[model samples]
Target: MEMGAENKVGTIKPEGEIYTCPTCGYTDGFHVSFSALKNNRKAEVFLICPNCHNRFRLGWHVDLSNT
Candidate 1:
């Protein structure tokens, strides 16, 4: 099958955050970034699974430093 631009692995952001792909059950290789509410205690992230090329939006709490 021919993969389109959405499926092609282009320039990925250099971040170490890992996420699991719900579509293909891949546990590695995902492009993740904070989408909104970054200043708040909770935030949302945009993810693109490299294994299955599926996109996901997830909300999570931020880990604040005690310092």
Candidate 2:
């Protein structure tokens, strides 16, 4: 199987601010940030699931405290 348009975001479990992968439900993964939004307040990251190796393009709400 390869990554294509079919590999998109679906169901996401609302378990606090921690965002999990919608495809494999993995709690942890590698993130690659490409773009920023809202004056660098938020960012778009390529989240790769370690469990299933599924890649997801998701919007990440930048944490102000972390900045």
Candidate 3:
């Protein structure tokens, strides 16, 4: 029985959204992806702070379509 990290399955898709941290100019593309299946069954976007290397997750969804 080998349960490795690579065996993890993600259901989320990256919509190419960039979020800027207020504390710093850390701009990281927030990829829309799935995490924690049971208690947390919601999709989230993550942004890594370049300055402080802090990981930020925006728990909100926004339509980036022109329409």
Candidate topping TM-score: 1
Predicted candidate 2 versus true structure: per-residue lDDT over 1-67, tens digit per residue: 3434344533334356645666667776445433454665555445556677666554445554463
Per-model TM against the reference: 0.41, 0.37, 0.33
> Over the stretch 1-67, how does candidate 1's per-residue lDDT look in tens digits?
2223344433324346655565777887677655335455545455677777666654444544455
Q: Worst lDDT window (10 residues) for model 2? A: 5-14
Could you tell me the C-alpha RMSD of candidate 1 in Å? 9.9
List CA RMSD, all candidates. Answer: 9.9, 5.9, 10.5
> What overall lDDT goes with each candidate model?
0.54, 0.52, 0.42
Candidate 3: residue 53 lDDT (0-100)? 44
Q: Put down candidate 3 lDDT per residue, 1-67, tens digits, no spaces.
A: 1212333322223345456555455566332333333344443344445565444444644443355
Order of the predicted models by TM-score, top scorer first: 1, 2, 3
